[model samples]
Each structure stands twice: as C-alpha cells, then as structure tokens.
Target: MCLNLKKGAIFVADSHFSEVNVEFLSFLEKLKKKEIETSQLFLMGDMFDFISGESRYFVKINQKLIDIINELSHNIEIIYLEGNHDYNLQKLFPKLKVYKRESQPIFAKYENKTIALAHGDIYTPKGYDIYCKIIRNSALLIFLNFIDFNYWLSKKIYNKLIKKSICSKMKDFDSFAKKRLSYYNSDIVVEGHFHQGKHYEEKNKLYVNIPSLCCNKKYTIFDGKFITTQL
Candidate 1:
C-alpha cells in the first residue's frame, strides 16, 4: 500500500527482534543512512523481550544499544503500542513511546493510507489480562536475559515457540479489527503480534499481518512519498 508520506513519514514496527541478526541490522543501517533519527518510529508491540521476573521493565538491549538510540534521539519519535508482553509500558524508558491501548486506527493522508496499528495480542478469545500476568514473570526470560540474551539462535528459537503457541485464532480480537476497519474503511490495516508476515486486501481494504521480526528484519518504513515495505 502506498500511503505517500510527508518528510514526517516514519517507521512502524512490532516485536523488534533485537541486535541478533547481522543481515537485519545491515538493513536498519541502510535505512539509517536515509536518516532514521529524523524520522518517526512507531512500535506496535513486543518491542523487547522484557516480559518477566525481576523488573517492572526489563531491557534486552544493554548499554551499547542504548547508546545507539541516544545518538538517534534528536531525529526520531519512538512510539510503542502496548502488547501483552509489555503491559507496564509507562515503566518503559523514555526512549520508548508506549501507548497504553488495545488498538487504534491512524490516518496517514500524506501517505494516502489509513493504518490500523495494533500489537495483535488482542486476538485471544479469552483475554489479554490473564496472558499478560503469566507471561510477564517467566523465569526463563529472566535467566536468558541475565546470561546471553539477543543471541540470534536463542531468539529464533523463542520466535518459533511463540508461533506454535498461537495455533488457535483469537476470533474476538480478529473480528474486532475487521469490524473497526469496516467502520473506518481505511486503505490499510497493518498489524503485528501474531508474528506472521503476510498481507490481505479487498477491493477497498487491506489487512497487513506483520511479523515479529527483530531490529534486523524490521518490516515497516516510510519516506516523503509513502508508507510501504515488506513485513
């Protein structure tokens, strides 16, 4: 979908994979070359793997990574749409702009597209409140981050496990999105949380299933022209 953006056009994302993949980081660098700092970055959910144990907000990215962001702070506005894993968003550091919401519809006239940015966790028929509690304090998350977090292999494995767990479609939230889209009838609905990367479209509608790609395979981007990229 071509939502032609203004220079204010930015990047939207979810489940930031982290500094594990060389290829992905290279991709980010390429975008950075275009000026990542000056652009805005919207995170749909799961920006990091801090859903657990010891702290209110745990960061997988350490000093070096924080340093990288400090460098880009001047040029970008980083916003985060809270996901099940990252419920206590207000606790997230200043760098992450966490929106305490279930979902929201955004209008990008400059890009000529209407975007529904949700972390995709609401799909659970039961509810996110329950899931959030259990997932938030896993010993594994704590142990892993304490040791060698961000190792590509471990992250890949983690992603695989998360996928397997979402085997059943959470119709409640899914239908919620569909209904909302009908209400807004936006040009596109881009979402993440399922960790599945794909796109769906109708005559006047589009639904984007964003993958939980780490910082490397990160999927959304925008230029002065439009908001377009592969998930």
Candidate 2:
C-alpha cells in the first residue's frame, strides 16, 4: 500500500524506551494530553530497548506507552516500522499499522515525491543479515519464550540494553550514505537505526536518517520537507 504522507506528520525513531530512559513516555503523555498534536505518527524503529510480542515480560514492562499508543491509534494514523530492538509487534498492536523488517522500505507518496521508508538495516553485511534473521525469526522467539524462566533472561537483556551507548557520528557519513542510497529507487529515502539524524542529497535524491529520539531528544515532522525538532 502506498501511504499518503500528510502535512504535519510526526516521525519518531529509536526512542529506546526503558525504565531508565523515560523521555519517550513523557512525549507520549504530551501527545495523549493534546499538548502536542499531529494527525499522523510514524514510529521509525527501536522505540523500545527490547520488545517482542511473544515475550510476556517485555510486554508487561512497556505496557504504559503501549497502551497510550493503542488508544491514540483510534483517533489518528500511526505506522510502526519494526527495528532490530523491537519486532513481531502485529499481535501486540492490533489497532495500529505494523510493518516488520522484511516488509520495510514501504512506499509513500508526498506531493510529487515517492518516499521509501525503512528501519535502515537493509543491505548490510552477510553476518549481520544472518543475525537479524535469527533474532527476528518467529520460531526462535517462540522457543525462547517457552524456555524463559520467571522472566530472568528477559530482564538480563533489558538491563544490558538500557546501559549501552547508542549515539555516535559516523566518519565520512556522506560517502557511506551515498553507497546505501544507491540501493534505493525513490525520490526520498527515510530510515532510522543509525542515530545520525542526517539529511543528504545526491543527484536529486534525498536521504533522511532520523535522529535517535533517546539520544537527541528529537523527533521529525514532515511538511514539504523533513524537520527535526527537540522535545
């Protein structure tokens, strides 16, 4: 399906929400209270540090933000593109539009532009590709869910992720991005996961790397162009 990119659409990427980082929660609260308003919301990816629909422990921990999002979905349009840290979300978010990693680079139309949206993990090295597939495999997730003991494994993973550093500036990002952009066939390519929040243009094609909301306290609004703003 080709999504129509509306004016004032809000896009949030890599919030990495956990007990330690509650910035995303507060942002959601503002949206819920109508302090911030938008007709469309795009959850680019990794909105949580570690979340899976099959994991009951993870669900229990992140229920507050989940609930608010589900409630908001009733009145507005929300598209959630699953990232490395969060996936298998179709069940957990029945009301919202959920797109898994494989189904990404979804096409959208904005004025005369054909935009490609993804979680930004595609066209990776072979080793990383295998790792992503293994991690996102439903069979593996089910097996882990079956073996989890009192949520011990889940807690360990969450604790580790909450403490890890995820922000950095890439060396020669322009060159790196150009290589990636070569793989896309769109007027604009938008993605999250790199945490760089860069905007680049080469040969008339625009590449937007949304900033990590957790690291930058920033989110994006799409009007005629992509706008990054602090919360």
Top candidate on lDDT is 2
TM-scores, all candidates, are: 0.58, 0.97
lDDT of 1 at 195: 56
User: What is candidate 1's lDDT per residue for 1-231, written digit by digit as tens?
Assistant: 222334644444444434343333443455467634446666666655433223422344433434444455456666666665555545434665555544344444544555556675543456665755555554745565566544654556456644443323444555544654565556766666665455555676777665545532546554432345543
In model 2, residue pairs whose N, Cα or C atoms come closer than 3 Å (at least 3 residues apart or on different chains), thus clashing, are none
**Alpha-carbon error at 92 in model 1, in Å?**
3.9
**Candidate 1 Cα deviation (angstroms), residue 58:** 3.8
List lDDT for all candidates, in order: 0.51, 0.91
TM-score of the candidate numbered 1? 0.58
Q: Which number leads on TM-score?
A: 2
Which consecutive 10 residues in model 2 have the weakest lDDT in total? 154-163
